[model samples]
Target: NLEYQGAFLYGEITANYDVRNHLFEDIKLRYDDIYKGHTLELGNYKYMDDGAREWDISFKKDKGYIITGSKNYVIKENVPLGSRVELLYLGIIIDIQNATNGVVEFKNDEIKEDRNYQLKIYTPDGKILIKDISTTSNYNQQNKGEVEYDINIREDHESKRNKIDSKVYYGLTDHLTLGMGYLREPELINDEYEYLDKGRLEAVYSNYIYSLPYTFRVGGDKVFNEFEYKVNEKNTKDDYSYDFLGQIDIKKVRLRLEHESKGEFYEDKYKTKFYVRYTPIKALDLEYEREEATKRDGIYGIDYKEKINKYSIEYSKAYKDLLLTGEYEYHTEDKGKYSFNTYYTGLRTATLKLENTWKNDGKDYEVAFSIFSNGNRLFDYNLEARYTEQEKDKFTFRFSTNYNNWFDYEMFVDKKGNQEHKFGIDHITDLRNPTAKIKNMDSSPLKVITFVDKNDNDIYDEGEELIKNVEVQIGEQKINTNENGEAMFYGVPNYVTYDLEPKIKKPNFLLGNNKVQVQGKNTATIVAHIPVKPMLTLTGFINVEDILELNSIDKMRLYEELLVTVKDTNGKVIDRAIPDEQGIFEISGLLPKKYLIEVVYMGIDHQIDGINDEIVKLTYVDVRHVS
Candidate 1:
């Protein structure tokens, strides 16, 4: 039987034999991170149960196969690095601890350190490789507080040359390190001017200017640059170059700068770099970079958005259903010459975006389209619609309107027998479960047009009329603002309010300042403004003799949302209300409680002192709602 706890596995066993068994295996599966790193699997699994035994099992897992005589594993120092062990615990046969079989081994069997005095070499895979002095080496411990030497040699033959060069550093104190090196035999042309030798000395400190999210890092790389160029086989001019980079993170944004100078004396060329970024707000980001005429240059980009909120206009672009963005980018050579061609004064890059939606229940529809232009002069557009319903006698509505620079197309459908005759354009047909078919027009990358019902007789009634701008508002409460500057509410008990206000200012045509009391859902339409007129007025508020507005009512009806709060003294909220479609709300399942009634109507709210449902409150009556 075996048991598991935390990150360890425990097991037990029992067997019988009294000196009658010969060569009986006594193995206790012992897994103690047997091996870790490159030469081993995540951890090694050894089958410690060498021969047949009373009970045994092996698993290549967290509890890698190990068998020991005791419950705990042997200490790393006690276990010989290359030897395998198998043991017995209590009365159980554990596992197998296979001997090392696939690698180089020495007579003493202690992981051979570098075979020779070599520090780096190459494997058959042709990849340059490096190995550090093992922790077991006295040389490593002697140089403990020093930068370990890292050497590199050719993948061809490492033992032949001292291409094995590395910088070794030794620490003398907490802030200072004394270091020196002669790693490479710098080649000399004609032996006139050469690198000869190189060395370094440095100091470091902490606990400087402090900030929670920002940090400052300062360091320098000093490379002795020396070399002479041979012209016509004779020593001529010399070449030297040095460089350094400073990077810091200030408040989450990154700041980086690099400075480099090449060539000796008067011919040296120096280049300086600067970059900064700030994200002051979550939704907006700003950046800037400049490398001057010495090479790099560019005024980066800043972007933001404001599309989903009410009373807002979108400043965006689109291409074939994909939305694009805008930004300013300057250039000075890097991303390839002509990356920012100075030859063109009018050509600019542009991105596009298109909106898409799916339709299945299929009756409701809405459309919005726009085209933004830059010097790139690219084109893009997309339209989407969706509708779903669960009822049959559905008088669903769908209408089209044009708001862009595209060709126009018209459509109409007639049903006969079991087939439908769709007019004007091509229709791709699709059908789904429980008997439903959808016929749609083909989409294109070119021009597009929208068709609006002309005579208001959605039947595609022929020869009736074809008015281009015939005030196409769809609904039964159809209307046209008369010469008297207004259209009367018809079919609809109350005049309709347009969600968007007008933009023009002259010859004002507006929603009537009147309220109609009727119960039930009703659709109303009214003449917004005359052709070429600018009227921006809304009319939907009740009032009381120039002093206050209509705040409370008894048996009247309303269509908008209301926040009804029932409360008592000490500002304690007792209950609240949310009305439904018919402007009728009966908050039931309520236990008897004291409450002050506050009614939210139109844009104003009204409350009154406690009044029992047993008494009828008069219309438009004002009560202290409580003191």
Candidate 2:
């Protein structure tokens, strides 16, 4: 069997298919908000909301309308000429009319006051409209003028039988409601087939009497079993019944009492039931119920009375990952019988379950054990294990075993106890595109770029280079700039401020804006400027006299004691360097400005003015007397 349910623009649709039985079981279309307090339904639909009795047999191709409201309101609608209209109260067809001059109207007098009425319209275009009249009204002062109704219809295809049931209720006063119902069905009576009609009249009262909530319903039923063959015999039977329910609440405990007297149609039985429930805390619940019933029965025309009493208690408690539940029932009739049951589970629905699921890793594991019994003997037990893995492909493996009569404790053990074992594996290559994509309309995209600012200006110049592979932290997300020096974040909430910080630290480079505040608007773009610091290196050689008189070690130490210092225009010492045996000296980390380079050797100072040249070469001469 396969079933599917979906919603369209206006309403909902449901379809079912039974491969083993009827291939196309049924399909239904329902629209609840079609018009003002109206419902439209087509195909196989239930006549009653509670799925009790009334049902459309086969496929109802023509759509119909269901209207609910009270009699004080009038219904006026424009439709095709000569359209058929029906008014149903409870479940009974009360009136039928036809449209004239492209319009139809239902007056208030034609409608009974304080009664729920339904108007079903069948247009010429195979469309049906139903309007509910009574439920749309506002009755704030008193409920005395309100009315309700229930209707159900059932059809049996094999027997070609149809059953109709309907009930109408009216609030006579603030606390009392009067109702009447009718039911008709085909039955086999005394070797003769006939249609039995049942009618009932009931009154219900619900209110707080002396600060105690109570409700009572009294009704009488009359059955008419008119037979064609037995016309002379009496065919009418009547019975009366009543039910009373009361409840009292005291702090965390609640007590309830119910008494029911069933008529002859229900075996002429009387039952009294009591229930108590207590909850001292939120995690625990305790409940108990007792019922006593007396029934009159006749065996071979010997009338006798039988009495039965039943008692049951239920307890439930939940703690962290585990839940415990237990129930016990005792019944006293011909032979006393008792049963006890208990259940425990880590998961709310599973009897005994263990599972580990990792959605990101695409792996899931589950093991479960379940058992069912009738308190006296074990019925069945099931053990199952399932593993699922979903990465590039999806794979699932399942193993299960079911054993019947697992613990019967019989004299002769049945080795081949009723058992079923199943093992299956499924592999799916593609689990993608399983659902439709939805676009977020409330968010925007934000793009951040980082670039080199060579002109000392905050703006990015045309020829300026763009920095790549730089990390930019926006909000809580860190993204690396692509080759285009752009980091994009899509679907960012609008009208929010995010702090942008660059994660690059260079020795001679200063970021124009270390921290930037960017607002996420529609398609926003921001740039982080980094200014490259000016740095120059100065290199020169030294000229020494009588170089041949010294050895290589002496020559190497000739400039070892010679120190060179560089100062900016402000006379601040920027850097210092010493010459090697080759008489080559280099000074680095100088700004793009005029600097003074001074060399001190043998207490003699040689000064050279170095401009903004990337490589400054100079020769220092040692004009000292022979020592």
Candidate 3:
């Protein structure tokens, strides 16, 4: 298609493929962003392997496979020799006299997104990880091509991830730490020791590597991993895995020592698996992964995954405008493989996306190339392009067009073999745009006045000139350019700051560095233009253990909200709470710092300022015990 009245046929098909022989003719479309938010994709697929009956656990005459582990590239600068250490480096239950509070010893990993009003409170506090884990299995074998009748094949299975976890972390000292993880599934092990599943306590210790070029340490793991089959009679829930990995780092190299063991009941499984990656520079990375399940029961059929995942390399540039990324992943598992009984499992999604932008003639144009592949076939190539003109102060012309499979070259013998190809593209735009959407009060000066001290004096002493071009913000809303040092922050949520981190990046900046999503509603900005400290206070009645009901806060500072809620029978809140012009709060609520006040406030607590009602509770919760 050609340009018809300036609106060129943007969505073009540049690929050549026999559409008449495929399920989908031409796939074409363009979207605003690739990582579309608010989406949960669910899909299913199936596969059947005919070489099942020939399942032999003999490693002698089998395929030549390398059962070694791999690692991902990581910056390898071991800091302060001993300071650069993981939890396992400390040492097992070793502590000297006194000097305890010195070394904080805990491994923490936590991701919490409270859907309770979409409160994505992703706090990275140490020592919290693993939300939910689930495991299941089922299997049955049958004759291949026989009219057999009375012939029978063993059928049995059971798998589960037990709850109860022993976080028991013994802080040996300020520089050393030790901890363990224990799990057990008792109720499911009924009369069969084979089905008795339990995870042994996992422990680790990290110690400061005194006097070394880089942080160097060694640690080990002792896990009496349970099994699914006690005597190979189809262990119901008794199947577990355990492995030990030792690590050492100096200069820019990282080494890993792995020694694992699988009970003899399970065959063909590896006894140990390990690998490590070391980065010579921040821009380069390397990795490898390996696994072995020796005499592993229920792994091949309906037990746990007894197969191995090996030889995968993945590299990525952490900081780069145009990043080069590639990875090779290969795995073989029979547990969930498709079969005649239940043939639905494993959903793998792969897509190749290519995007590039060019600036010339004071205008910017971006072209996106993508290919979605599945089942060893190229489903479609979405080749899209967009152009924009930002020569004005308020508006720009955004013109986008894409080729529907236009770049597709299918069944083409490309020096190697015959490959299939398909293509498509899409885009849309608003010719007219506005810089500021002033609403609420009729034309109030959305002034963003930030006071910056040119002298770099900590105090805003008199005679200190205010810095120009500095930013002022209000809940992620901001504007710039003015003489009075104030920019428009219209429609901004009251709690303003010296800098309003953008909810969006400038198109020019985005074009160069792919794009960045900066999220957060802050009332904290750095500036000398405004010499006002947010009045913080506690106006409501707060009590111990009460998860502060943040949703009830008005245009008040969090500190003020904490003051209102005072001494009350556990779980009581304060009456109406509000804040003064200054971010200050009146602590009407009673309670020592001992009994944590579900302080909805931050700063004196945490510096999270937002109106989203995502409560910033105390650092830790007080748990009750019952006999």
State the C-alpha lDDT per candidate: 0.28, 0.50, 0.29
Comparison by TM-score, 2 against 3, better one:
2
Which regions of candidate 2 are displaced past 4 Å? 1-10, 19-22, 31-149, 168-174, 190-192, 224-234, 239-303, 333-368, 371-627
Model 1, residue 168: distance off in Å is 4.4
Candidate rank order under TM-score: 2, 3, 1
**Cα-lDDT of candidate 3:** 0.29
TM-score of each: 0.22, 0.38, 0.27
- lDDT of each residue in 47-116, candidate 3, tens digit only: 1222111111100111111122231111111011011122110111111011111112221111011100
Clashes found in each candidate (C-alpha, N, C closer than 3 A)? 28, 22, 112
TM-score of 2: 0.38
Tens-digit lDDT track of model 1 for 292-371: 32321223432221111111011222233232222223333322111000011122322121222222222332222212
Q: Kindly list the per-residue Cα lDDT of model 2 for residues 287-386, writing each as its tens digit.
A: 5566767666677654455555545444444455344434344555422222222234333322442333332222232222333111111122334343
- Write the number of the candidate with greater TM-score, choosing between 1 and 3: 3
